[model samples]
Target: MENNLKNRREFLKEMSVFAGATTFLASIPWMKAFAGSDGSAMAPSDRVRIGVVGVGDRGRALLMNMQQIENVEIIAVCDNYEPNYKRAIELTAGKAKAFYDHREMLEMKDLDGVIVATPLHEHAHVVVDFLKAGIHVFCEKSMARTLEDSKWMVDVQKETGKILQIGHQRLFNPVYLNALDRVRAGEIGQITQVRAYWHRNSNWRRAVPSPELERKINWRLYTEYSAGLMTELASHQVQVANWFLDKIPTRVMGSGSICYWNDGREVYDHVALVYDYDNGVKCLYDSMIANKHYGLEEQIQGDKGTIEPEINRIYSENPPAAPGIRQLLHSIEKGIFETIPIGGASWVPETAVPYRGQIIAPYDNNDTFLQLVGYVQAIRNGKPWKNLLREGYHATVAALLGLQAMDTNQILEWPAEYVMEKDL
Candidate 1:
């Protein structure tokens, strides 16, 4: 644990130099939120008491990450499902109190914060309850299953004046941090377009132990609980696009269908969307469960270069040693003055070529753990990171908008009712 802290400090220091800012860390939203009034770090002795609302897969993962940080205590765990409840209690080594109802856990006076990992449909309800109870919250991404509910969550957070950090872990990643800095520095020049996709070949389902538990265990396949690929996968990529572009799209259009997995799933298995931003920049997105060849990627394209942040590589539009150099070498070797063309016929044209990119960030850190630590720090400091919360809010609204556009088969503009007054 000591070594991990040391390495993180060194990595942040190095990235600060790379970003050409002496106060790069201080400029980050989470960092600013966690900093004291005098710009000092929080004392390690200030312990934070936290509870877990849903102890399923993602919730259990957060519990595991929480155990690694110091000066933090898991005071309570809640889940209605017996198996998950038992597993969570076991993970806590029986030290934390157990509850089947989240409302009961909210009665604990000492609980400072809660990690809400319930299904998408329950996010608005559970998160609203916690915020109204005067507890800071770290809820999973996409905010809620519906746009109105998502907006309500944000409004309640404002009314309560409590910290609400949505689960957009990429915002805390070192590689993404460096990439954002580069994009801001014009390394990629004016952003022309962005392309992102998430693909898988498997039927997105879970093994149900009993027939009645199908809805409980496989909630992601039902529209009542999930928005399928759009909210589950595209939300993250669209958040990335918004963060790097520093602007939100004015409108969205898309189409979706249950093309491959037709096992009575309520949501689409395939979706393709186009988000039109200001300055005529567009973000293209697609996902399907029929093929895994392309896997997943968020490709940010600009006039000068392209960045694939998932792979941590950047490709230049015009790489050094092009047709001029290569053709000269070929002509000299062949003892001819005629100009020699590169690969493929000149008239054939090509969409892509082999251009190995440079690595952006080489060091890897556990962003999940870092995000968990940030949440704890924010709780201890008693302040909310509005910028971070707004990023998640915009992404969730964009995804839900895409779903609406697909369902109605019409181009949809950002709704006036959902827009925050501060944004206007």
Candidate 2:
């Protein structure tokens, strides 16, 4: 444990230096908050008091990650669900106060920030209230179930001038940070295409203790509570595409159907979407619950190489020569220019390169942990990272638009109503 802590401190020190670089900060402006003005790690005395709402799966995960960071206190937890509330209290080891209603917890005056990991439909309402109350927020992704709600949340944050960080962990991930550096440095050349997908065989449901708790326990499988695969899963990958390309889709087209998991679920079991960006860049996305093969991946392809962030691999367009070719080159350099008969297969099929590729980034701690730390840092500094909300907003709008396109069987243009003239 001590060794891990030491490594984490060292890694954070290195990242602080990396984040302080002018070129890297210019490209990823949000990372500027990662470094202190004095170029030192956040002091342990800079403690942050935190509250968590909707203490379910994602909320618990965030709690666990937050606890790992020094000087962070889980002051309070709120949940309407009994099981989750109990679990959260236990997870905090009884250190945090528990409340059935978020409003009651909001009455507490010491919260530096609140994490909203509520269901899709609850995000806007819960987050807006907290922001209006002058508390910083770290809401889970997709912003909200509806575009209007999502936009309204962004507006509320702007009005309040409090930190509103959408839970896009990749934004704080070292692997993705390194990949972004390479992308900006033209290591992969100009990005030509982007593709991302998530696949799993499970029904995407929780085991309900009773029939009465079905709706509350497994809200993800229903349309009234969630957009299912698109908002919950695709939104994360879509955000990655937006961040990497630094462009949101101007238009999107797609299709979806409940081909599998036909057990009374209101949402699609599979979906395929195509998002069109400026300069003819396209992001093709799809997700399915019938198969787990091809799992989750976001492939950013450029003229020179391809980056798969999930697996931390970069495949170059040009690979090194074989041993025989190198030997031939060696011979030629020594003045052995004998002509050899070129005999090979008449039809050589072109395929993906055999090279497994190189690791794109160094091993690091959990991205969620890093992101939580950034949130606290932003709170301490009283400065919101530029365009961070914009990234979340664009991705949420794109995902909702993709669902609209899929349902209507037509291409959907980006809605002008939600487009921000400037970053908030």
* The 10-residue segment with the lowest total lDDT in model 2: 338-347
How far out, in Å, is residue 309 in model 1? 0.4
Model 2 misplaced stretches (Cα beyond 4 Å): 1-4, 25-27, 36-45, 322-354, 421-424
Each candidate: RMSD: 5.8, 5.1
| Tens-place lDDT digits, model 1, residues 1-424 | 7786566555545533543442554567675423333112436568789899999999999998887766689999999999999998999999899999999977899999999998899999999999999999999888999998999999999899998888888888777887777787788899999999999999989999999989889999999999989889999999999888888889999999998788988999999999999779999999999999999888999998889998889888877676667788778988989855665345666647455798878856577776887788788779876477888898899999999999999999988776654332
Candidate 2, residue 312: Cα displacement in angstroms equals 0.7
The local distance difference test score of each candidate is 0.85, 0.85
True lDDT of residue 391, candidate 2? 77
- Measured against the true structure, the TM-scores of the candidates, in listed sequence, are 0.87, 0.90
lDDT of 2 by residue, 307-392 (tens): 99999999889876655566677778998876633334335686575559998876674888788878877887777877788877
What are the clashing pairs of model 2? none
Off by over 4 Å in 1: 1-25, 32-45, 322-355, 421-424
